[model samples]
Structures are given as C-alpha cells and as structure tokens.
Target chain A: MTTGVRRRMGVEERREQLIAVALELFSHRSPDEVSIDEIAGAAGISRPLVYHYFPGKRSLYEAALRKAAEDLAERFEEPREGPLGARLLRVMGRFFDFVDQHGPGFSALMRGGPAVGSSTTNALIDSVRQAAYEQILAHLGITAPSARLQLVVRSWVSLAESTALLWLDGRRVPRAELELQLVHDFAALAAVSAAYDEEMASVLRRILADEPSDGPFTDLVTRLVGLAPLPGSV
Target chain B: MTTGVRRRMGVEERREQLIAVALELFSHRSPDEVSIDEIAGAAGISRPLVYHYFPGKRSLYEAALRKAAEDLAERFEEPREGPLGARLLRVMGRFFDFVDQHGPGFSALMRGGPAVGSSTTNALIDSVRQAAYEQILAHLGITAPSARLQLVVRSWVSLAESTALLWLDGRRVPRAELELQLVHDFAALAAVSAAYDEEMASVLRRILADEPSDGPFTDLVTRLVGLAPLPGSV
Candidate 1:
C-alpha cells in the first residue's frame, strides 16, 4: 500500500545499486545490446537519475568492470601463512569459483580486457593481474623476487587467465583438477626458470626445501630430474 | 598494365582472394566494423560479386577466420626429427612468428574462438586446435596417447594459445626465452601428470633416455635436479 514512497539511498549505495543491475544485465547480454533505459528500468530509477550518478553508459560499464576486477583482486588476497602450495590452491579455488559465478560478465571484462576499452580501463584490468602476481609472491615469502622470478610469475599469471577463459568457453574439466594443473604449471615454470636464471635457481632451491619428498612437487622434481636420489641433497 | 583486363581466376582462387582481402580488413577492425562493401572494394571487386561466392557477410567473416586458423595450423606443424625439446622449440618459434605477423587478425579469430561464433565457425577453430594437438603428439611419436597424456597436451595447447594472445596484447618477451619457457612447461607437466598416471611416468622415462649430454635438455635436467645430476645425466 505504501509502494509509491521509496527509501532514499546514499550516493555510494545508489551507485552500487546501479552497477549491480548493470553488471547483471551485462552478464546476460553483450554490451551493445544492453541499454541505459534497461539499466534504469531494472534499477527502478529514472533515466536522468542514472545519468546523475554516471555520465554515460561507457563509464557505467567501466565501473562494473572495475568492480569485477576488484572482486577478483580481493579474492586473490589470502593470508600468506600456510604452505605455499596449499595457499596457492586456495587462491586458485576462489578464482575458479569467481569465474563460475561471474561467467559471462567475467568474459566481457577480461576477453579483450585492454583491447576494446580506454587506457584507464586497461590499467584497471592490469592492476588486477598485478595484484594476483604480488599475492602469489607474498605467499611464497619472496620479498624481492628476481627478474627471472618476476618473468615466470608474470607469464604464469597470463597462463592462468587464459586457462580460466578457455574453461569458461569450453566443456570445462573438473575445477579441482584444473586448479591442480595450474599449480603444477607454476611449479614447473619455477624449475624451468631456474635452469636459465641464477635467482630462479635459488628460488627453486627454497621451493624444493619446503616441499615434502612424497608430494606431487617432489614427484615432479624426481620425474624431471630422473636418475636422481634427490639432487642438491649434499 | 592492361587496365580493365584482369585475368580470370578459378572459383577456388577467387574465393581465396576474397577471403585474403577480408582477413586483412578484419585485422584492423572488429567483425562488426568491417562491411561487405569495404571487403569487396578492397579486393577491387563488386559487392554482389563478393556475395556470389559466399552467402553473406557473416559467412565471409567465417571464411576469413577459417583462413587464419589454417595459416596457424600449418605453422604449428614441423618435421619431428632430432631431440623432442629441440623440435618443440622449433614449433614454438613458428607459432610466435605467426602471432607476430597476424597480431590483430590472430587476436580477432582467437579472442573468442569458440565463444560467440556460430557452431560452424567454432568448429573451424576447433579443427585447428585438434590439428595442433595431433601434431604435438606426432612429434612425440605417440600413436595412442593416454587420457592423461591427452589432458596434459590439451591444456598445454590452451596455455600456448593464451600465451600467444597475451604476447600480442602486451609487451612481448623475447621469442627464444618465451618458447623455451613453454617447452619447460610441457616437460614439467609431463612429469607431474606421471605422478597420477603411470603412462605419463613411462613417457618421462623415455624422454629422459632420449636426451643427450652437453645439450640444453641435458643442462636443464641437471640444473633442475641440481647437485651432481647423474654425471651428464646419461
């Protein structure tokens, strides 16, 4: 009976409400197909009111993208107290979950992340990637990772993103299996980078030292370093 | 030049010509941006003539995609002689080269390879991926690759593709180093997969047995294993 009179939300709350509506619409439809009127109607607000908070559709889309990127960045941030592998797996699990929940919206934001957007939008996406890289390093307890360590981590991050996209686009394998494979790829890259970079060699030494001998990492090192009763054991 | 006296090309050649022109145009613009008129005009042909060979603009775009996919698939195949690592390095080199040449077009075709495209177009793209996977196994001489082996290779292919796209999108690392990193990834994955699948474990043994001393592969295994490394790892 009192439906005509609505409670007024603060500026931040209003902006967030609009973005949430826009994000949901964008998840189901391409950006071009989703209109401001639809967004306003979906939020039960006037078109002019939607414009008051955001200048235009592009800006609103950018905000939505940044929100997604922030969600991902936050998910990537975990306590760096656990064993590096377990910590990475947890982060990866959260990442997969985010991908599952966000599906199409995640694809829209990440597909051509920097390609179809402005430099500012691109930088926002880059920030998410950088945040993930830094979190992984922190989990490994590396305060000053070397150039090779940096490259390996950077490339591996790209690989993880690509894998995530491919999974969302295809008949995705089991999430646990995919997450395990990513960790294995990171470990492999660490060992591989060590072959070419002295800093990486030291990093791998630490990784090897931290790992249990009967673990997957240990078995991986054993298989790669075949004919070994465990090297660097002297 | 004999103006207005163009030589008559066969239907296949004419279609190839039209597709080539479309591919070049799509390279610099999105599929929606490139028009049927522009494609025909660019090829110095009439609009109806362009449509004569293809049903519509979407079909034309699909043809362009198929062309790029074929180009990439061709580049990934290489003579599978000599060391496996060396052979892989060669294939990666070609892949990087292809990416460098077709940066935008490659991205266009691959950005959503199977995402938004029609099933036929998606199938064209899938065919390329399947071809690359088969070629990789061929290089390894695996006639009947186990499920784990298939999974590892399939994931690696996805990784390679993602890396290529990232390289094109971002500041690219040096070709040799990036290629080496991929090789390392494949080798490491093989070892890791072996932990879960006995077939992979046996594959690693054969890989180890084939690698020669005083080579990069030998050095890699030694450095990864660390310590004495089985005296040249023979």
Candidate 2:
C-alpha cells in the first residue's frame, strides 16, 4: 500500500537503503531464511529492482556483512583515558550490545558457518578480530607484544568472541556480570602469562600500577587474594 | 601394480576400507580438493566401486567426519587418578596431538565451513564439545554445575578450541607451553568464577587441595601469588 507513492532515491542512496534493510532482516534471522522479495517488500521496492542493485542475494548478504563487520570492529574502540581493566570493560559492554542487538548476524559472522561463509566473508570477520587486537594493543601501549603477551591477548579476544556467541544463545548469566567477568578474564590471562614470563610480569606491573583501587583488575586481585591464607597465620 | 592380484575383501571389510582411505585423504586436505576418483585410486579400487560402498561423496565425507568426531571426542577421556591439573595436561597433550597431526581435518571440523559442513557435521562437532564439557565436569565430580561453573567450563572449552585453531595457523608458540597454559587457563577461568561464587570457590578449593606443589594449578597459584606484595613490607 505504501508503495503506491514511493519516494524516489539516488542510486547510492537506494543501495545503502537496501543494505540497511537487508541488514535489519538478516540480523533478525538467518540470511537463508530471508527472501529477496521480502527484502524488497520491507524496503518498499520491487523484487527486480533489488537484483538491479546487486547481482544476487549473496552479494547483498556480503554487503550487509561488511557493514556489520565495520560496526563490530568499532566496538573495540575506546578512549585511552582510564585503567586498562575499566577500558576493556567498557569495550565489552559495547561489544555485547552489538551481540545482543544483532544476535543472528553476530552468530553468522563469528561462526562463519553455512550461512554465506566465503573466503571474503572470513577475511571480513578476521578484519574485525584484527581491529580489536590492534585496539587492545594500542590501549596497552605496546609496539611489540611478546609471544606470550600475543597469546594472552589473542586468547582473550577469542574468549570474548566465544563468550558473546554462547551468551547470545541462552543469555543465562546477567550481561553486566559477564562484561565484568570478561574484563577479569583479560587480567587473569595476562597474570598467568606474567607468572611464566618476566617480560609479561613487567607489562602487567606497568598496567596494574595505573589501575585504581576499585578497578576491575584490583577487584580480581582482591578476589584472588581472598583465596590465599595469611602468612604464618594459618 | 598391486591391482593385478588384489586380495578380495568382504562387503563390510571393503566398506570400512573405503572409509579409512577417504578419512586419510580428507584428513590431509579439504574434502572438496579430494574427489571420488582420488578416493577410489587411493583405495586401489574403481570410482564405481567407491560409489557401490556409499551413495556419493557427501555420504563418504559424513562417514569420515563421524569417525573423526569419535576419535576427537575420545581425546578428552582420561583415567581419574592424577591431580586435576596433571590430568588436564594429559588431556591437552592428546588434544594437541590430534590438532597437530590432523591439521586440515581439524580445521575443517572446528570451523565447520565449506568443506562439507552439513547439519550432520555441525551436530557431530557439537557432540564433541558436549563430550569435552561432560568430561571436564566429571573431573570436577559435579553432576549439577551451577550457571557460573557451566560458564567457566564452556568458556574454557571454547578457549581451548580457539587456542588450538590459532596455534595451528602459525604454530608460533611452543606446543608444550600452550598445553600447560590451557590447563592454567581452565584454572584461571574457574578461579575467576570462584572469586564471585562461593560454590565455585569451594570446588576450586577441593581441586587445589588435591593438587601437588608442582602441579599446574599449584603453579598458577604460586605464579599469581608472586604478583602480590608482602602484607606489611610493602
């Protein structure tokens, strides 16, 4: 009915509009489930016009994926003004926001499974992961991360990723707790590495020195310390 | 040359032989790269004979995947005797052994991407994860895991999966250290939950009590405790 008086749009505007509509539809369900007619119907355009803009559904899906990948990569960005733990917590909050909002799309992107998992799609997802990695490195202020540090950072990134994917499934735990726990996870991972490598210990010390008493890292320290018995008191 | 006077195999024996040959070839490369002709040639039989055993390539691929899944699932099994950390280390050793030996096959199985990733394939992969999860819970001796414990265990499993996937890419880190770190990672993940949850804390205490001084969990505690300053000296 609304198509009776459709507003005209430029080529680029129409393309952008189509992608936005497709992204919205794909975010709610699997791309395989959504049809081009449905996409055009939602976008208030003809089905043929949808193909006029893109070769096929796969192209449109890839376009939507590219946009999602960009948005997700930016979720890792935070102002470098606070303690590392707090900064990471803020990042996790935003990261989870995206995961919560785009549950299906996030799963498809992260899983890289049957739903249009091309080499290009894999690269796009990898780009998002790489962006997050670089942003964390920037926050850590490290130009050359040691191998153990790389393992810690990379492992934490994967942990956050899988955490988001699993969280999306049932959301069994509270979002706030999961976000803070992820921050704690980062610290715990680095602390383990620090215990093994002296270079990592120095990195950890430098990061911990700037943390506030009430920061997540300090909270982790307090919690872990609670497990320890007092020297000569036990 | 051996085809001149090949030994005759029974129906069941030939079927098993074909699957073994297919698994060997698929494990070496992606299933897409290996064709029916190749499978037959590898099996020292004709392509039609390969089809006689199975309907098509997809069925054979699924059969091979099923076998691989069972083997991978068994990798998590260990005798319940040693300290938790040592037991986990042994499990990780076997896990990486599979990952290291079956590099391409493991990637295809874990990624569940283009290499014949049917729903059946995904179910098989999930079965392996469930098996690993249950095995870890059995090690913890918990029939009813709290939400937080479940999160820790599942998160550790995902962490181990991703760690192995990433490790396979470049193998930049030493295999032995990565295995130990994964054991440490399980403790680290559980320790964080124990920090927040009394139930997890008690479980951690029980596990830690059984751990020897040089065990991985004990090593994690010692390493983390070293990061702390003296109560009065500092």
Clashes of each: 0, 0
For candidate 1 chain B, the 10 contiguous residues with the lowest summed lDDT are B225-234
Error of 2 at B15 (Å): 2.1
Please state the CAPRI-style docking class of candidate 2.
Answer: acceptable
| Candidate number with greatest DockQ | 2
Residues B1-234, model 1: lDDT tens digits: 556666888999999999989888887766767789898889888999988999998888878888888888998778866778888888898888877776776676665432224556657867988999999888777899876677778778877876676666654456678787788778777776676677777776776667666444555666666621223323
TM-score between candidate 2 and the true structure: 0.93
For residues B111-217, write the lDDT of model 2, one tens digit per residue: 65566655787788789999999999999999999888888998899999988988887788889999999999888888888877888999988888888876888
TM-score of each: 0.70, 0.93
* Tens digit per residue, CA lDDT, model 1, A1-234: 556567989999999999999988877765767899999999999999999999999899888878878988999988866456666778889999988887776666565432234555567878988999898887777888865677778778877886777677663357777787778778887878777777777766776667665544555555555532232343
lDDT of 2 by residue, A1-234 (tens): 366565789999999999999999999887879999999999988999999999999999999989989998998999999788888989999999988888987776666557666667777877988999999988989889887788788889989988888887778879889999999999899988787788789888888888887788877877776774323321
Off by over 4 Å in 1: A1-65, A80-83, A103-127, A137-150, A162-174, A206-219, A222-234, B1-15, B21-62, B78-83, B107-126, B137-148, B165-173, B210-219, B227-234
Fnat for each model: 0.24, 0.44
Candidate 1 clashing pairs, residues 3+ apart or interchain: none
Please give the CA lDDT of all the candidate structures.
0.75, 0.85
